[model samples]
Target: MPQAFPIFPLLSYDSRKNSMTEARNWADKKTLGGRGHFDLQSSPASLVLDSVRAGDEGLYRCRVDFKKSPTRNARTNLTVIIPPHAPTILTKEEGQPVWTMVGPYNEGESLTLTCQVDGGKPTPRVVWLMNGEVVDEKSETQGPQRVTNTLTLEKLTRSHLHAALVCQASNNNHSTPVQTIINIEMNCEFYVGFSCLKDNKRGMDKF
Candidate 1:
């Protein structure tokens, strides 16, 4: 009977640093020390990350170099998932009567709706929607994790009445986003003492 020896392939793992160098070798089975947050294990060859952070999310590549055989390589991506908190909506008006009611506003006025989400890792994306349609808006990042998106409606008309304004916060980790919805209100001048009556009638008609 002949004794058999287990042949192991040399494994090395690298992360992209910049466009010039391609990838910098961060961990290898042969070397030790100065790995920071990266851990390398032998035998089967595996890489372990310790105390992952938001900045650590990126592409990673692993290479297996054999002495006489062809060199083999594999690539993978690492995404850090941090679900954001529930979105909050704030309404602001200039030089006009502010409507605190859920749904009522005067026409020919400008209103600002600010959507905010606080405390999320990897920075969540905030989106604004009007009547289920995506609204073009820019999101601003505050500190490390907070995000704010503002939408301004100019020259408000009765066409906006009963329309739903939604703010949603999402990340890759969450299947469903955290959202808040506000229904536009018709001005009292339009229909005296009939606030939300149309909504109720529409709901009843569905049944």
Candidate 2:
């Protein structure tokens, strides 16, 4: 006579909740159904994720317990790929778009431009471009998924006038980049010498 094998109970570990749920009940409210986008299958016992999102990333463990026998378990990390959000470009001084004409900017003055992205999984890389030329600089992580990149112009010059400045944010998961562009403009004074001459003439007349 052939011996009968005892059936084992299947379980799944929810790393986000730090709890274990029966395989058949893996989609219960306390497990993944509350958040949706997840499902469990029997026969070979598999987990299915639909329309995955960044918040759904984490380590998932599967276990089986047999009566009068040792337990078996396996774990796999799930990473959801998401593209970065559109980047925002602004002047460091006013926190507004560099194209906004608030006031005149003098030549030879240092200016800072910042590019930021609100969210992305695994963070995103920001790159600055001047007239389509890449500006080699480092970017800082503001939060878990927020990132900022800064570019400094040591001296504003006539050549920078009408120049296009662009910021692009990207990640390995997506080839398309989120970007923003701004055109530069300089102060209106055409000749400093002419202004100085007018000032000197006023001083002579007062004497």
lDDT of 1: 0.66
The lowest-lDDT stretch of 10 consecutive residues in candidate 2 is 2-11
What TM-score, computed on C-alpha atoms, does each candidate reach?
0.50, 0.57
Write the residue-wise lDDT of candidate 2 on 1-207 in tens digits: 533222432233344333335323434444444455334346564666556666667666666566567987777787786778888777788798654332245778876888888787657888989889998458899889789998888878778777777888887754788888887777744754423233575565321
- Candidate 1 all-Cα RMSD: 15.3
- Per-residue C-alpha lDDT of model 1 across residues 109-188, encoded as one tens digit per residue: 76677787897766788989987889945789977868999888898887887788888888765468888888888673
TM-score, prediction 1: 0.50
Model 2, residue pairs in steric clash:
none
Model 1 collision count:
2
Best by lDDT: 2
Instruction: State how far residue 121 of model 2 sits from its true place (Å).
Output: 1.9
